[model samples]
Target: MAGVRPRAVVADDSHFMRSVISDILEDGGIDVVGQAKNGRDAVETVADLSPDVVTMDVEMPEMNGIEAVDRIMSENPTPVLMLSAHTDENADVTFEALDKGAVDFFTKPGGEVSMEMSRLEDQLVEMVTSVAEVDATAATGSEKQTSAPTSSTRTYVENPTLLIGSSTGGPKMVERVLSELPLEADFRVLIVQHMPDGFTERFAKRIDSRSDYDVREASHGDRIGGGEALVAPGGKHMIVSNYRSGRLRVKLTEDPPVNSVRPAVDMTMNSAAEVITDPLFGVILTGMGEDGAAGIKAIKAVGGRTIAQDEETSAVFGMPKRAIETGYVDDVLPIDDIPNGILNTAKAEVN
Candidate 1:
């Protein structure tokens, strides 16, 4: 009992799927302490069994994953890794679960099942193992999702080009920031959120539904304009191309992954820094690893405004924390203040 392998509960509505996941986890060396078929059962099992981590299904019966996540965090606060389907609607709910304080997520290889489900075995094991190691107490009191006041007195962005980057715990953090960006703060936003292939498109659609401006996945020749945003597709890199101040566009590249990940924030942030000269804003939010640290410095070399989400507000504080350590970050604000912080930086006079 003293040296038992870390225990986990596999939660899903389907028996076959649960068996598959349980086998993977057990084989990967974690003990399958319990299993649940629905959100309510998952919540209750977590309380009763108190496993090291929970693999939650995003769509479950009785009480959907979002509501269950809220209850679990409030009552038990155990680490949770969501398993989600790649659909626009589920994308919306997945982010909601993250917002409710789940540690991270892994997308199921396909909608229902296929031979490809086997591909997720290694990734699933890795996520569960790594997340089990997270000190959830360190991430307590995550920044509350709220809007910064948007008023005429706020600094005005002058044809600004905004670059956003994140990795772990990013989907919800990205959505929260984009959802609250002021309508009057018209700018072209390029985003690089580290996710697996085929997930970013749905993420973009989810943002589009809630954002005041148009939000969609970046393509080879998409025109970026005021009140428009582009999310880098998951498997391809996004770069600024055919650049004109008011008419910037993006192109996707199949170049190999950087920092061991495709669509690295450094790739897009550096690209945007190359083209945009005036009123550029670079924001590095919550994530793991140092992927964006160098790119934020690139923004600063050109006098672009750089902001990193502060440690207390970040889910992992790896990217933003590393960016801050470089001394390139102009401001280290909480997640809620980041959108407004960009506006304030944009309004400053550039000598």
Candidate 2:
């Protein structure tokens, strides 16, 4: 009862919606510090209250969630959790909010609050708790650093292949992991991130600008190489196939959606398993849903090394949790330690 209790502000146009969210947070043992009726009020309240987290709604009077998120991030830098409607328009806005620094989002369930509240309550609590922790750590700037993976001392074939999957917080997570990796690391990394068209290109460009690695939107027939990262283009499925020269190359197609997602984690993971049979390193990072669980199982079945992001360090624990629960993960690591794990695993194969 003594550790830091999170203070959160709820922002929405409807009083009833705000009340429902406040109730959910309070039930989760988080303190409801304040409430706001619109984006403008939310920004003002956040500036004044300096709460640990802010739950913002996308459509509001006087201002919108994207503008409010930009203002909040620019002025105060507090963690933000966007409440988005379940629609394509809202999804687009949600991604924009993330690019502007909002940490995560929850899709507001349609229909009666009483009926859907129970279903969404857990998700709400999860987002609030995780974002609050991140906010507190950011404010103190004293978060404990994660330890890097040590050499395994095992020897294997040195054909290193990288498989990465991400969703909600993936752009940032992937960027951080790829940036921290050594520039000369010998491997080809294939990234499958849940995103819509027009966003993957921008996301890849952002990562490329921040990292030493050559990151780009993956193209059909693009040859995988060392010191580069390939992002699966939005709206397409990316697979790995063997090249005539025996190197793994990317194969893009308009395959039927798997796991309710086109460019799903399972598709990419299964494809990587087929093409890279030796010493594969598969990683499932922060995201929503169980899309990567099957893929991780496939990789593990083939003797590949598999890793999942620990729940405590993930923005959303759905994907990683599923993979971990399925017992497919060889290691469950914090986000910061993931890059080092990949390096250590890759190094282990070469030794």
The lDDT values for all models are 0.82, 0.79
Measured by lDDT, the strongest candidate is 1
TM-score of each model, paired residue for residue: 0.84, 0.69
lDDT of 2 at 86: 60
Question: Model 1, which residues run further than 4 Å from truth?
Answer: 1-6, 14-16, 26-31, 59-67, 87-89, 99-101, 111-118, 133-151
- Compare the candidates by TM-score and give the number of the best one: 1
165-242, model 2: which lDDT tens digit per residue? 988677778877877766656567788988766667777877888777788999998886666778999889998877
Which portions of model 2 show Cα errors greater than 4 Å? 1-39, 45-67, 70-100, 105-157, 243-246, 348-351
User: Could you tell me which residue pairs clash in candidate 2?
Assistant: none
lDDT of 2 at 308: 96
Give me the displacement of residue 275 in model 1, in angstroms: 1.9
